[model samples]
Target: MKEIVQINLDNEMDLILAHKRCMKIAEMCGMASSLQTRFATAVSEVARCAIAKGKDSLLVLNINIIKATQKEITAIITDNVDLKSCSPDAFIYASKISHHIEYQYSNNQSLTKISLPIPSPGLLSETKIKTLIDYFKFETPLSPYDEIRKKNIELIALSEKLAESENKYKQLANTIPILICVINERNNVLLVNESLENYLDKPLLSFDRKTLMNFIHTEDIDGILEGWNKAKQNRSNFLGETRIKKDSNYIWHLISIVPNKTEDGSFNSWLVYFVDINAQKMMVETLKDNTQLKLIQHELENANSKLRFKNKELEQFAYIASHDLQEPLRKIMIMLSRAGEHLSEDQKKKYYFDRITSAAGRLSNLITDVLNYSRIENKEQYFEKVDLNKIIIDVLGDLSLVIEEKHAVINVNPLPTVFGLDTQLRQLLYNLINNALKFNAKQPSVKVLHENVPKDEHLPIGAENYEVIAISDNGIGMDSKYSNRIFDMFQRLHERDQYGGNGIGLALCRRIIENHNGIINFTSKPDEGTTFWIYFPKNKLYTAKLSLKNQSSN
Candidate 1:
């Protein structure tokens, strides 16, 4: 046997070169033209398969001489790739072209060999073989058939990839919340997701540009066109708010258009999405109406003005109350569902159950706070000479268990008596003391001090003197930036997980102080401590009358 040629099959060009060389070798062996074509076709197919599925492949051509009686031409394609994994179609095509085709595997290499036998008298002469060898020295022209086959394979692979991409696109568009539609450059709808069909109450197959335009509100057509034109000119996205007809009623919808362009920078299509914005639009309108109403009623009678303001405040409070309450209820439901799953595991069950219990306790506290806030003005008026010392003592007794657990110390500085509602004053002292104790990191020490401001000290009118009560505590204080915000309902400074409270303690105290015609203020530094000052006016006439009434009743 003699080696005719050896070529590395690394790419398409290498495969073509191998095929041409095989054909020329078969010709030089004096094989028939038909046999030459068959041998070359088989070599081309096998070489392509090896290059596509294998790594570092080589194509070898050899001459076989059997005892000077017979001569044969053979081509072998070998690579370090799995032969069983090669496409069956390539092997089938090669087998049809030549009966001497066979696959061999040895030394961890896959080899496909094809042989063409020459007749005894048809063996090539020495001169003709040398000429063929010289021809092989130059590059061979690519076979048209092989070129077509390569193109066909590429097209098949590309088609499969495109189909996969289309499937993923459909899945994403249908699963998302927004309505999606694809439109071609001719203004014709090409595809729409199920969301669009559901929104229109009709199948998308029956929709076109005209049909879609009919469903849009008449006033929005010009705006939509203007936005679309701008998007096209700038090659950017278009966004606008419009109304679309659904169930014979118009609803606000936000439309977003994303332009798709071809490689030549020409328009190809557009991707449009619709999002429902009726709730947001309605909220804006409601706020506008409320502002206008308030401005119109500002000059009304004092009684009516107060009533209107109170009504507005109640409305706002109701909105906030419902929203805040839902948070805890949602947590309770989620924890309960999780607890049901871990009922058999005692530790897991207890963990989730404790969370559910905490959420429920928070819900209860919020309801109680809201109830107390609402009843601040509804309580019967009962002003009397209330002793601050007695109120503080009662509050301390009520919180005795917490005080003991925290190892808290209480200091008093002769709090003066004042004319106010006894129950409100008791609640005010309780909240302030509880806040100081709850936020403390170390053993809490609280001081209750008071001083009487003389007449020249500038107090509210109709007051002989003002009693300023200062309650200071060593606790985990907060930044001064949130000093005013601390009195807002549901405005918590720390995360609920760190400091567990409903954020209503200070608000409740503020309300209670306001009912007694007093003002409350606070000062604090982070991690240091805080002090709350309450100013209560002393009205001589009211105190004297209340004292006389108390004497008569006794």
Candidate 2:
């Protein structure tokens, strides 16, 4: 058996890094992707449980060779939580994924161990194990404070090497692809590469720190200085992009400066490298321009589409108005003209006058319904918190006379407070109630009920909680074949002379419900009562705002 690595299960980030390391090691051991994922998941679950339920938990990994041909990878998670008090489901899941699992408890501490057997012809040779051990020896589990101290020691040793390699650096810099320079503690240029000299077309020995700043673009001077100062203070690397003057034009370059520190943790100097990235920057700018052009073209197409739709709607409205509205007025005019010329008895005149009056009434109703439908499209309504019960009561009060005339009996259940346009909701209720009473033959019995419902495939996207409001009425209903057609503008199943309607009531109701991000449908049969179901989203206010934003953007 050989110890591989250990990690402290302290926080969420640590747990995440631990799992990543486990997966990486499993991959190095020639494990398949599925097996690697299983090991990582099992390690994460055990480590998370240990961190949540216990204190000072540690996760250890090891490799053991069996029969000189097979290898087994194991993880041991130790915590202070009592074994009996721990979650059983987590271990059971781990057991299913792993080959073997065991729990050990003693001296107020508990250990959960999981192992997976590797396929034959294991990849963990002696040389590979040595490399892994050497790479991870200093990376063993340590307190955060100890880790910082170790990093500081490494930095100090690197500083000594930088000071001693002046000649060797000069020889190596000439062959590198990037331009390199060294800046001393006093912020003066100590040395520069041949590449830098060739690019600037000047001798490195003649230029100083101030001369170098003159070559950088004026807009980027402050930003570059700020990044440099921050890196100096933190004893870290500074990375930035800026334009540098070359010949008569400016070109982009990526600057990277690595700080060298003294043994006492003080700043020594910076080793800076300049990488030419003008081609990459130009490509990015070109792509951005193309993307912007595509977006503008898409917007133009959307605008054209909307214009076409609006024009079609206007044409249909004009056709309907010229035919439907004028027909009634034409009949009235012809009837009155005949009555005036005949000069008959009172009964004959009364018959023609009544016909004229009925024609005029139908014309008036057509105009009113058209105006109401048009208002629904053109007017912008404000949404607010509305009580359904209050709206129902108000509607009932308004239709009290008609209800009494029909002897209609309405049963209302407790309703909910929903977000909607107040006036529109009231109009919707009024239309539905009036239609139920007008079409009924016997004593009209209507039931209004509402209840919360789950989200289903029928609900619109972004709908979370919904309310289904059903209005059932014992009225003369139409055939089921006209279910979808009933909501169309001026679509009347019954003849106007019999039903006494312009066919805009249901259409208007449909539009109002749609504006609130809801859907309306009904079930009806000839002689059977109709039950209209309206599905209203509880969070209509949010969806409404989103809709407005989308429209405005388009």
> For model 1, how does the per-residue alpha-carbon lDDT over 1-554 read when each residue is reduced to its tens digit?
66778899888888767766776677666665446666777788888888788888888887766656677777888889865466789888789768998887878898788888877534565565567667778863554445434433332333344345446545544755567888765567788888787787555542234565767887888888788777767878998998988888998888999977542335688889887676556555655676656543443344365455645554456345544455545554454554355234453332234554565577667767776666566232577789998999899999999999999999988888887888888889999999889999899999998865455422334334457888999999889788757897777877777777777778888888777766777778888999997877676233221112223455
Model 1: number of backbone collisions:
0
The sequence of per-residue lDDT tens digits that candidate 2 reaches over residues 1-554 is: 88888889888767766675676677678875456666766676677777677788998888877768878888888887763367677677666666577888898899888777777545678888777667655544422322322322332333333334434434543755578888875567788878787788555542234565668888888888888778777777989998989988999899998976542335678888887776556655655676667655665566566556645555456345434445445554454555445334453342234554575577667777776776664232567789999999999999999988888899999988887888889999999988999888889999999864454543444433567788989899889778756887777777666778888899999999887877777778888889887767777444442122233455
All models: lDDT?
A: 0.71, 0.70
* Candidate 1: regions farther than 4 A off: 1-351, 378-381, 452-464, 540-554
Superposed model 2: Cα runs more than 4 Å off:
1-351, 378-381, 452-464, 541-554
Among all candidates shown, the one with the greatest TM-score: 1
Clashes per prediction? 0, 0
My TM-score estimates for the predictions, one after another, are 0.39, 0.38
